[model samples]
Target: MKFLRTALGSAAVSHPAIDLQTSFTAAAQAAGLIKAGQQFDPFANENNFLLGAFIFEDVGVTAYKGAAPLITNKTYLEAAAGILAVEAYHAGTIRSALFTKGLATPANAISKARDSLDGPTDLDQSISRDGSMVNVTPTDANGIAFSRSPGQVLNVVYLTPKKATKGGFFPAGVNGDVKTSAGR
Candidate 1:
């Protein structure tokens, strides 16, 4: 997870939240997700690395979709655009690779969600009266035992510390009296 340690250069969302970084990291660790480390052999298992790549690519695609709206900074938006394109390429290549390996079924052949290359732009704080699925709803859906709303939230794994760039208590980043890099 060295790349993770470094690539998370800035504090995004605290873990347990469904943001791009945590989702990608968790997907990498999952069984059906990408296998980056050693001991990877395609013939070893029927599902093998091919499936992992597909899942990873799929995760990448949706991750950008999930994250794009939250990003307000122009620089971040530019980076996200690049990431979105890269994800598309990754998915295309992996889809072909999976087909060659006979792992992908015909039904699973390339299809996307309702939102396309462009994502949700206008984010409203409250729900709309039109009864649209895309309308927003804010509530702790977890409070109820059973619910049918998509308002389901992820666990609060970490908290956004006072500072964004430096290590702090919540990210489990560093142990120190001063919230910072040394001598700052």
Candidate 2:
């Protein structure tokens, strides 16, 4: 918490945090995904949602990277391509923002904090500094943005590389097929 405040700066944390439970409930209701009396685990769902974003983005990219033929439907392949393009744009936007905010300082601090929680791994590379030198954006051998596999993502969420059913971001486990680390 203190690290978050320091990394994000005092002004960013000045206001009280939003009520995540209420917000999630309202969002579910608005989406017509939940009934008035239906029960839902907002905390787990929220964590799942956050983790799912990265998963979806990586999957979208992977779909276009020689896996396009796996999709029997041409329309679905096109949709996957579209999703990949959008995710790339979104990644660029985030990277640009981080660069503007001084990637070598605060962004690196936040990345270090995340790495500490997630455990050291190539997938959890720091925004600035690959080793002893500074690094802005991580790229593959061909200079393309790096992508993480589902297992790598689960490793981060579970806070360990070992197989896990639940822990870290998902204490009670995520919902559906992707609930456990083994599911990856």
Candidate 3:
């Protein structure tokens, strides 16, 4: 975020920034993910918290990778690639931790939930092991990571398969033209 802010500040284009004061959507609150006044807890519990982290990191990696081809600026693309690498590393570490602690079932559940939100096609994978082989990286048969469109990504965050401008994480909606989530 700081990097983008700095880059934009140095450039001619002045894109509107994300609203930092945004609250969790009604759906999230009703689901008891967080209390009315409490902040989103990163350390809510051992398993649940790590599950959140796992989801976050994995999404970060895929989102970055998905956006790579759309980047026209070489410098920005390089920076994004660096960020993607870091996100991938973070995701791998989280997956390894979850596997070591035997949280594959819950992790897979979250993956399935995300998959359902994204689209009809099942692109998500389970964090599982085959005998002694641990499955850390979730990929296709060709070993390619899956990509989600902007709307698809929004669907997951918005917690809906229906087209929506607001719900789930962004109660007041995102602050740009691409605020709508795709209806699966």
Candidate 4:
């Protein structure tokens, strides 16, 4: 929560409809991902934290893509590209870590949970199948990893295919234009 507080600060940001620090904590608690009065433990919170990191990266990628056309400044565009690269790195690192840990069973369970919440979607890749470990990375035709759109990302976070305003990972809803629905 301290990280959230520092990143989002006390002032309300117009983009994320609610205060990110407050909404994120409330949503995580509401979803039982984190217990009230519990100390933050990275190892204990791995699943949730990874899920959050995935969502964060996806949102950033989508946001950057959406804003690209409107950005007339070259410097801003370059900065956005750098930021996106970092987000991609974060996502890839999480995916690799999960795979390396042989977390197939738990990853699949989490995938199923997400699918149920966001509705059935091909976008949700299970880390394992047929009793074997498998890669869960989203890839393009060349087998290269790809970024997800905001909506696709939300579908994973909300754990449902249906367009949701709020639920699952975000109880109150994310701030800005993203909200709980898929991004355009």
Candidate 5:
């Protein structure tokens, strides 16, 4: 992120210091996805950790794809495309891991939860199987992955279906001009 910021001629100092676990837990609790006292421990359990990893990776790919047209610089657009490829690879790896563990149900539940936050449209997807064939890649009917706008991305991270300036993964909110989340 800092690399991209610098490449765009912006200072990387906008990246704020945050307690990820605490913010995640707070947002999850607020959204009623987890118990009040529970922490968002990525390694607390295999399926649980994989679910978290899959969500972020999937979102990263979509976010980059959605933002591509907004970027005017050819060099930066190329860089973002490369990053989107890497994020897609990460998402596929995590999806495969979830499928290998036979966690389709739980993974789908997480996907649904993300969908709820993002918008009324059910663009989010999960690992599934069609008899003998495993669906490792989440895509549309055309086999292309879906995209999410910056505001939609913020809605998920903020853990709210309503427009919000702060909550979820970022307790104090993000820096810069894009800080508001989209309403579901």
Candidate 6:
């Protein structure tokens, strides 16, 4: 079979192995950002509601993109592509909350230091579980050209924090910035 997937982060190609996906989801829930049977309704109060969600979702999208090239199965590759879309949609929803007037995003309340991607240890910086880098292809204001590396993509997005400038968008943790159906 001819694999038409030539992109570094495409469904026909890049997709994290199932185990990684499960592990990541568990980590997210452990962070208490996700609740069982609860919708993604970010807090509109001057708290870091959307901010927390943004960090989770944005990191997730990039994580998949960073891990995509490492997968060798087409079926899993397609799933990753679908999941990435869902992650993006989640980000958008959180961003929209930022526009709710008087609302404060996590980035707004939490100090940049607390939100930093340095992880739990000051000994080193990490992009993935294995100390690898995160590569991400960031499209511009409009969908167009982009470039990414797994290490650069994920780490860079979370290493720094940013505030949003407009509505219907949440700042990507790294410059930070994903969708789907089936609760994907």
Q: TM-scores for all candidates?
A: 0.38, 0.46, 0.78, 0.54, 0.86, 0.39
Stretches off by above 4 angstroms in model 2 are 1-77, 112-121, 129-137, 182-184
For candidate 6, the 10 contiguous residues with the lowest summed lDDT are 175-184
Off by over 4 Å in 4: 1-12, 15-76, 115-121, 128-137, 158-160, 178-184
Off by over 4 Å in 5: 11-13, 26-36, 129-133
> lDDT for every model?
0.36, 0.45, 0.69, 0.54, 0.78, 0.39
Number of clashes in model 4?
16
Deviation (Å) of 46 in candidate 3: 3.6
Over all chains combined, what TM-score does candidate 3 have? Answer: 0.78
- Higher-lDDT candidate of 3 and 4: 3
CA lDDT, candidate 3, residue 119: 80
6-110: candidate 2 lDDT, tens digit per residue: 443433324333334443443343334456876434447433343223323333343254344555766556665666677666544454445554433434433
Model 3 bad stretches (over 4 Å): 10-41, 129-133
Give the number of the best model, judged by lDDT. Answer: 5
TM-score of 4: 0.54
State candidate 6's TM-score. 0.39
Candidate 3 lDDT over 1-184, as tens digits, reads 6776555355424443332223222223433444687554445577656776765677787888778897798878887888888888888888888888977776766676677788899877767745244578877788877777778877877778899987666655676457798887
lDDT of 5 by residue, 65-142 (tens): 899988898978888998899899988888888878887766666777788889889888757745335567878899
In model 3, the clashing pairs are: none
Q: Give residue 18's lDDT in candidate 3 (0 to 100).
A: 30
Can you give the lDDT of residue 42 in candidate 3?
41
